[model samples]
Target: MTGAAAAIAALVDRRLTVAVAESLTGGLLVAELIGVPGASAAVLGGVVAYNTELKATVLGVDAYLLAEHGPVHPEVARQMADRVRSVLAVGGVPADIGLSTTGVAGPDPQGGQQPGVVFIGIAFGSTVTALRLDLSGDRQAIRTGVVSESLARLNEMLNEMLTGA
Candidate 1:
């Protein structure tokens, strides 16, 4: 099993639900999570906000915030996670953790942000944090790297939660 699947399985075993909001990686993060057996138990759902409008409209991201900070900013990632959590909670999935990835994964950079520059946000309860990763690769490779690293970070956070370390 992939590391993401395994980490998700661990979360499920602990009865923790997870939701993802993806931008550059699209639905690839959800695909990796649901690729595992019994992912339905832990994975609440996901939002693929490929467009800025949808990110603001459907995910409830603030337009002023997006316009002020742009989509690739860390605050955008944090808002994405918070919005996903709120959505999942209303849906009764009630996710305990939310993960979001936003970035430019492309042959040419957009939004004045460099390609392979990713912001991954993690939210647990009222606490939200973002990690920035500057990866080196082609489009697909960068996306793959983001997915892998996001899962690793999730695992680390899970370990911290479980071990209180």
Candidate 2:
């Protein structure tokens, strides 16, 4: 199975729900997850916070952090993941997992970062982790890579949980 499909299956099997927050990858991360069959059972929703201001106003990213490190920082990714669960809550019940992507993917730099510099943040249970990826590709390729990497990271985490690792 594809990584995205595997992650979706794991989530469903574990009765876990996920919300996504996106920046450099736009909405592609959520799109990839929800594209899998039966994803509705685990994917609550997603936010495309491409704008720095929207990261705070919509996803509740800290304004001071954005002012200091911009939207491409690892902390931004972590905050996006940590907060999206609540932001996309249903009936006051937050999702079990939050996934976020924040980075620069382009021929030009963004927030002083070169293209293909990415962070994928994942929040599950009480732990929040940011995985940094220094990729090498054009804009579209970089974005695609981020989605793939995010799913792989989720799959790894799910396996760890399942095996009690």
Candidate 3:
């Protein structure tokens, strides 16, 4: 099983559910997790807000923040993470964790940020943090790298949270 799959398994054992929000990584983040068998029980849902404006409309990111810093900002990632968890909440299946990816992975820079600049926001329990990554590659490579790193970090975060470390 993939790292994301194993992480989902562990989360399920802990009775925790997860939701994802994506922009630069698109839907790949969720796709990676759901590919693992039994992930459906722990993986709540995901949203792909690739459009700069849709991040606010669909994920409830602050509109003024979008206009001020665009979609690539760290706070944007944080809000997307938190909002997706809330949006995907069901009566007994509330998402306990949120993961978000937002950045520029392209042949050109965006919002004055370099092309491979990425932010990964993860909310585990009551703590939420955005991690900045400066990747190196073409569009596809950067996106793939983001997926790999985000899932790895998520797995680590889940372990830390579960172990109370």
Candidate 4:
């Protein structure tokens, strides 16, 4: 199954919801979920932290970390995922999952990292993990891959967390 369909089904079946924080993929990751029907039953909301400052200011990525390692680092992705889960919460109601996308997708590299070097972060229950993806493509393709990989990571998490498979 597609990651969007799998995520929505698993999330809905388990009475859970998800939020996102994005950088390189922009809003594409969340947009994929929203495109699937009944996504509202599982998707809470998302944030696009496209700028370096916004990574810290908007999504709560540590300012020191951004300065020390820049926005494309795994820690940035992890923080984006871990913190966005709290940011989307309202009145003590928090989403059950968080996902993040951060990377370099460009004609020129950022933070000394090559193009298509991405880290997808996921925070589910008591666990938070980051997936490093070194891809080969133009800008759009890299971003597209990030979105697909992000959802697939979430799909894997759903399987492990819910289906034990």
Candidate 5:
């Protein structure tokens, strides 16, 4: 199965819900999850916080952190992943998994970081992990890479949960 399909199946099997926060990849990450058949059983929703300010005001990322480290920092990804579960909560219950992407995907540098400097954050329960990726390509390629990596990482995390690894 494709990564998205596998991740969706695992989530449904475990009765887990997921929410997404996107910066560099925009809504592609959530789009990938929801594209799977029966994804509604596990995908709660997603937020596209492409604007740095929206990352703070909408998704509750720390403004001070964004100001200090910019949106490409790992902490920013962590907070986006951690808070999005709550931001997209339903009936006061947060999602079981929160995934986020933040980075520079462009032909130009951003926040003092070169293009393809990306971070993917995965949050489950009380644990949040950020994976740094130094991708190389054009804008679209980097964005697509982020989405692929996000799905792969999500599947890995779900597998780990199943095996208690």
Candidate 6:
């Protein structure tokens, strides 16, 4: 099994469900989680809001924030995480954890942010934390690295939470 699979299994064992809101990495993060066995128990759902409009309309991102910070900002990532958690609640999933990704992964930059710049947001219950990563790679490599690194960070967070570290 992959590291992502192991993480999902651990989350399931803790009876914690997870949800995702993705943009720059697309739905690759969700795809990775769902590829694991017994993911249905731990992964509640996910949203692929590739467009800024959908980030506002579907994920309930604030219009002003999107306009102010653009779609690739840390605030956008945080809102994406919160929105996905709320959406999952409506679906009766009520996930215990929410993960989100927003970034610029391209041959060109957007919103003045360079390619390989990413913000990962993690929400547990009502609290949310955002981490910025300046990565180096091509588009595909950057996306893959973001997905893997995000999961690894989640694992670290879980360990910290479990051990009260």
Identify the candidate with maximal lDDT. 5
lDDT assessment of candidate 3: 0.90
Candidate with more favorable, higher lDDT: 2 or 6: 2
Q: Give the TM-score (vs. native) of candidate 4.
A: 0.96
Model 3: number of backbone collisions: 0
Clashing pairs in 5: none
- On lDDT, who's better, 1 or 3? 3
For candidate 3, lDDT tens digit of each residue in 1-165?
Answer: 678877878888888889999999989999999988888889988999999888988899999999999988899989888888988898855589999999999899999999999999998667788999999989999999999999999889878867899
Per-candidate local distance difference test: 0.88, 0.94, 0.90, 0.90, 0.96, 0.88
Q: Residues 1-165, candidate 2, lDDT per residue (tens digit)?
A: 999899999999999999999998889989999999999999999999999999999999999999999988889999999999999999999999999999999899998999999999999878999999999978899999999999999999999999999
- When superposed on Cα atoms, how far off is each prediction in RMSD? 1.3, 0.7, 1.3, 1.0, 0.6, 1.2
Superposition error at 142 for model 5 (Å): 0.4
Candidate 3: deviation at residue 119, Å? Answer: 0.4
lDDT per residue (tens digit) for residues 1-165 in model 6: 576887897798788888899998888999999998789988988999999899999989999999988998888888888778878774565778889999989879998999999999999977888899998989999999899889998898888878999
Error of 4 at 157 (Å): 0.8
Tens digit per residue, CA lDDT, model 5, 69-161: 999999999999999999999999999999999999989999999999999999999999899999999999999999999999999888988
Task: Write down the TM-score of every candidate.
Answer: 0.95, 0.98, 0.95, 0.96, 0.98, 0.95
Residue 127 lDDT in model 2? 95
Query: Per-residue CA lDDT of candidate 4, range 1-165, in tens?
Result: 788998899999989999999998889999999999999998988999999999888888899999999998988888899999999996778788889999999979999999999999998877888889999899999999898888888887888877666
Candidate 1 residue lDDT tens string, 1-165:
678877876897788989999999989998999888888888888999999888899888899988887789998899898779878774565688999999989889878898988999999889899999999889999999999999998998898888999
Q: Please report the TM-score between candidate 3 and the true structure.
A: 0.95
Off by over 4 Å in 1: 90-93
